[model samples]
Target: MSLSKANKSAYFAWLKHPGHYLFFKIFIWFWLTIIGTVAALVFLSNITAINAVSNEPLYGPMKKNLIYTAKSIERSAVKHKRTLSEVLVHPRLSKRKLLYLSAAQSDDSLSNKEVPESIDLSLLNFTQNMSPQIIFTEKYQAFGPVNIKVPEGSFYLYEIDINHQPPLIMRFKLMPNWMKIVIAIVASLILSFVFSRNLIAPINSLKKAAIKLSAGNLSARADISVNRKDELGILGRDFNSMANQLELLISSQKRLLADISHELRSPLTRLKMATGLAQMQANDASQSYLLRIEKEANQLDKMIADVLQVSRLEAKSQALSLQKQSLQIIVDHVINDAQFEAKQNNKQLNIVGAVDVNINCDESLIASALENLLRNAIKYANNTISITLKHADAIYIEICDDGSGVPNEQLGKLCEPFFRQSDARDRVSGGTGLGLAIAKNAITAHGGSLVLSNKEQGGLCANITLPLIKE
Candidate 1:
């Protein structure tokens, strides 16, 4: 599609809206968020290790103590010749280290009341009967400090003489491997932000072009200056080519319609003039021949006019000489004019409820549409016809007739140029089958609608709607 600069910029603005761009930003932000989160964990681990072992690596001693406690219990068990549980009564790795073991019907119950150096006594449970083989466990308060790991169901409790002996405290911390990974992840995400921005730039341009195309500015073309000479640039080039072809095709079609309409005008005018002269010179028998000629010429004149109108509509050059007018007045007037023809066809004309309505529309154009619709209804009407006007958001003009209405299968095709419900009837009726088609075109030109449907009262109802002046 090809579009003007103003439309292009407007569409670009829509794409660049906060909500749209926010999504792209969020995609990059969240991906980076994950990376940053991982990297943060990694950095924290390194910091923790540097803080703990940079000088003396104190955790090594704490770890050694837990192992020592386990082995000590083992030796004591052998020396005392009781199972490890009975010999040591669960040695304390710290003042609060766990010192309990769940063995197979444990050789002896040896639970010390000292909490494990790394565990909270109230937060853990030990069951000797279930999975007794799981001899050890690590404990740490998530989102808190005092981190530690130790043998499961193990604690040492002894009523100590505090004044005589100094209380011992075991402090152990883990190697911060998780923190190191987090730091690496954070760094990667930061880089990803830059990458995502570069990736989406071309997409943003295409988005703008699409919006411009939708807004009736079909000339929009994308500019891809991305450093990566990949698919994005190719897409931009493709879009430009498509826009060029579309513009050319539309321009050509408009010119073709205009030229054809101009060419048809001369022949149609000549036929009308000849028919009029023939009618003026006609005698008794010649009257029927002259009448046929006049009818055919008038039909041709009407078709030529419709062709010109359609051409103007296509070129977007339809200028409306709009005036504030009463829809009811126009309806009544057209009905009066069409009534003579309805009477000549041995049909009855009936006017329904009157509606007081006003709208701004092209007077002659709207009148012509209504005139055509009423004449069509009269032609097929089986002796009875009704015209109605109603006030709503728009003024409605409805003309209905009691005749064998259009077949169910032919409704949609009725609006096509030269389409008629019954070809033989239309030929006998002396119409060129352009009445309804012309009415449709005229209504559309007035920014309104004309709809035809079978009326329940045994005929066709041509419904017209035109926007009323809001003020």
Candidate 2:
């Protein structure tokens, strides 16, 4: 069946307001969380790197130790009258600390034996000045290139410690900043998409179940698995429970209505038989009263039958016997009967549009519903009534009359069981008030709708729309 106007409008409204969707909100939140965490880590790393470069704990101690090693080498070379190479090989000076010295100009250095092969020596560019520089690598920290003068030529001294590894801040510094951000964004997008899908999947199932339940599918239930233990899982379980309770309650009510109507029908039948017997035995004066009693009993019987039909429709107790039939044949039968009634009542009923379409429906139910609507129009119409049929997305059967329109406030209640307007359209009009209600229920059972409205010029228009069966 096609979606109703209200369902279509709600879908469009959701499309129009994208920000109202839970998926959008959840995706954005997850994305922001991932980006924020990456940014925080980057910020902390930068701060730590800066602190290591300027703080006294790392930079100060490394500088002092480099200067002291340089001085010790120079003093040993001058006092022992030995070359700087011999002083560097001395076990007493070389084994004093886990430090290595590399010459700035010469390739000869202790780095090859003491440091990892990944350390790049070109990073340390020494000048003629006595000040030392610090260099960080993944595996080692080097404070280096101190100018050591020993009466011979000047020597460039580099102090390297193999045991001192770079911190977390320096390790990430190897990658470019833009690359880091790009990686973070890509990772966040993937993670956020997965997270939002996992979160919204169950919710979408719940929403579908709710729509089905609201659309008169009492057996509709959320397709949530028992393995889900989250809050959304709990909500789905609760929704299914509510739907079950609602279906049970409505089923019980429908059954109760049908049972009550059946019970009343027995008494009404006996009352009608008694009234007939009385009419047979009564005198002329009592004849009219007995006739009125028979008329009221007939009306009561009709009302009870209507009540039974409505309950059956509500409970879906009787399956529709559907067949592909010509719409024109059905309309012609109802119109012929209605037109004869209209002529008897001094009213004109005319068919204004073609009814050549074929539809899948229960013939008896559709014909009965149309008959009820036409009779209602005949009863209320002053001079003329019109039946107009049109086929578009669905088949539309509009029955309009030239009677005084109902009050605007009471229009919505016209199809309700036993609902009567307060003015000229009361019980005195020989109506049980269940005709429109039965018609509505019958049309609804066929996956169609009966809408009642007041014509602007003056009249009541009952429009019946039914879904066209696909070939």
Candidate 3:
């Protein structure tokens, strides 16, 4: 059967995830194991029962009829050779008898007759070996006395041909039914369901914990099977250790950035003071140089401050001040300021939609992040820029520009600190390359995401998504 795209994708997803893959693997294995074992039991039972029924004692009547007939045929065949052939076509036996007469002489019958081929040749051979005797004596056993009874319909003939003597013939039955064994085996297999559930319960718990961990709940642990001394217990312990280490390392990195940013501020303040002191005694030509030095110093100071803010946001040092605010007011104010700057740079800035909904947010932080996005849009816009906002399950703010989009390879790196798509352009534009990084950190701090993608038509699109507050 052909599968739809969604179904194919879902099947692939199940194979990729460890927990889902493991669950399917165990489920298939358990069912196949039960089926295979039940089938084996049924096969073995059929063999044993067929062998028991095929034993010589069960064919007592057939044995007596065959021996008497065979002795009379032997006695008459000495007078006429055609008598043996005539008697084979119409044997003197019970109405229940159904036998195949062997044409070959008894002296060479065992060597000439090959067993019938079937699906279960071994079992067929076992039953066929239990044919009854035509005559029995202590010194000369007839057809080798055996304990197994043949199945009801199956029969094999034995012929005795001596020198100048007609052939002596006898027949015995073999089994023809095997259904009862199958039904009994299927009934026994139905009771194994409880064992299957017990086997899956621990694995289900691990699957849940794995899914929770993948969804960013780092505290999730596979507590099941941890007490046992088996391989499962080892796996649970290992997973817990890895999660703890990952959490510790990320926490340490954030704390380190915060600490370093705090320490750098003191030296940067002294540098600005030193630059201002040198500017006091400079001549007119030297004053330009001093001003340039001062300008660079101030830019450096701003960059450091922005960097510190980013670290604080990541470390969660600043708590949110969420309050109901007019979305339209915030967007208008940010756009007005950005349009003035766009006009200075020979670019047109406009708003596409007016949003009047009240959203809960940290006004200062969100506004600052929006301003940073606008500035970036203005910086890269060739001639036009636009802003739009909407509220659904979440609030969305999109800032777009008509300039060339960033390279596809560099799109993901845009939010990383100090990541510049073009080093020369970033330097010439007086960009420290931390604007988008800081904006992303701020949005993430408010439980939102800042997405950057290339516009389908042209340029770059920055999307900000924040959850709507429940009233």
Candidate 4:
């Protein structure tokens, strides 16, 4: 089961990564090339050696002979010689039916007889030597040379109807099949593995560089590990150059936003103070109009605060003063503070859920976030608001209200700083559109998230997940 899973995973990775595919392709090609070249060389050498051996005049006119004379033309014993022609054209049934018909015939020629170990010279082509690569095995069943080799003699096994001659037998030595296959595979593996390593080393470096860059190190670069004039080396150099450009561009943008925010703070402060005083000095008739301007000035102030907070969070410049504290205690304090405002609007404030969970958090920031969320819920609720604390992987503080919930499609947009629904009815709430957004930012800074969704029946729900320390 494990091997099957591994095979499946490997196949998927190979399909997804073209580089892996290329590496295996080159490896296989290199292996095949080595095998083909070596096999061809070995085969050629064997054939050449066999030809050289066969070319030697390994036979003489009268090598050896064993013939029994029976009927002769006029009772004279035919010549007994080892020459191939003499063996076939001897007088009497010379242990070979064909030889008998071609010579002095007798019943002896029709049947073969057992004789001492010997080879039939006429059955083999002694005139031309066999190539070394030419197969010679166990007699005729297997095509390879026999184990018992006659180094100085040409031999062949032949069956003949010679009752006066022995059954012929011969043997020769040849290489084994298992040994050849082992040699081929071992040689191929060694050469291919070495070649593949050399070819794939640069690719491995590129993979490491890519991983580093993905892990937020934009300055990560690949070393020019390959010096060969190849496409891979060129690609490495180009990738390094591209990463450098990205790092520079991002740093420049961050600096620009930081500078603009810092420079705008002084003028915004002056505008906010001026608007307050202007509202105080206006006559009754203009006072209402002046108050409108004051509200707009407050909105501006709120947006500026959000911008500064966002910038601080992004720059990682906000220091957290975290401490372990009971989340129930925090919720109680915030609820106590919001109770008066809820009552003024004919709303009920309730905090009902699991309690006694302790959390490691920046107390002031978390309290501020909860306060904002509750206040927004109270403002939107039609007289009823509930703050619940549920326990799970984290402390979930959910605030649901019995008011007309947010527009279903605009749930995600409410968390954007200064983003509000476009309809006039939505803007009638008169907020700077930064309440939910700032709360989200603060929660995110504390390593939490602010989720917005509509209640099942009717209302807006804000679920804040706060990591708590186990008690």
Best by TM-score: 2
What is the RMSD, in Å, between candidate 4 and the native fold over all Cα? 12.6
Q: Using lDDT as the measure, name the better of candidate 1 and candidate 3.
A: 3
Q: Candidate 1 — which residues are off by over 4 angstroms? A: 1-69, 76-92, 95-99, 102-258, 267-295, 314-316
- lDDT for residue 329 in candidate 4, whole number 0-100: 88
Question: Number of clashes in every candidate structure?
Answer: 51, 0, 10, 13
Instruction: State the weakest 10-residue window (summed lDDT) of model 2.
Output: 49-58
Off-target runs (Cα >4 Å) in candidate 3 are 1-22, 46-225, 228-250
User: Candidate 2: TM-score?
Assistant: 0.70
Q: Among these predicted structures, which one has the highest lDDT?
A: 2
Q: Candidate 4, which segments miss by more than 4 Å at Cα? A: 1-264, 271-293, 402-412
- Candidate lDDT (C-alpha), each: 0.62, 0.79, 0.64, 0.62
Taking the tens digit of each residue's C-alpha lDDT, what string does model 1 give over 255-320?
Answer: 786688689888878877887887788788998987888776776666777767765654558888
User: If scored against the real structure, what TM-score would every candidate get?
Assistant: 0.54, 0.70, 0.60, 0.50
Query: Could you give candidate 4's per-residue lDDT for residues 21-46 as a string of tens digits?
Result: 66777888999998898777556545
Off by over 4 Å in 2: 1-15, 19-30, 46-120, 124-173, 190-217, 220-239, 343-350, 378-386, 400-416, 419-424, 451-461
Candidate 2 global CA lDDT score: 0.79
RMSD of each: 13.9, 6.4, 13.2, 12.6
At residue 191, candidate 4 shows an lDDT of: 84
Candidate 1 local Cα displacement, residue 441, angstroms = 2.7
The C-alpha local distance difference test score for the whole of candidate 4 amounts to 0.62
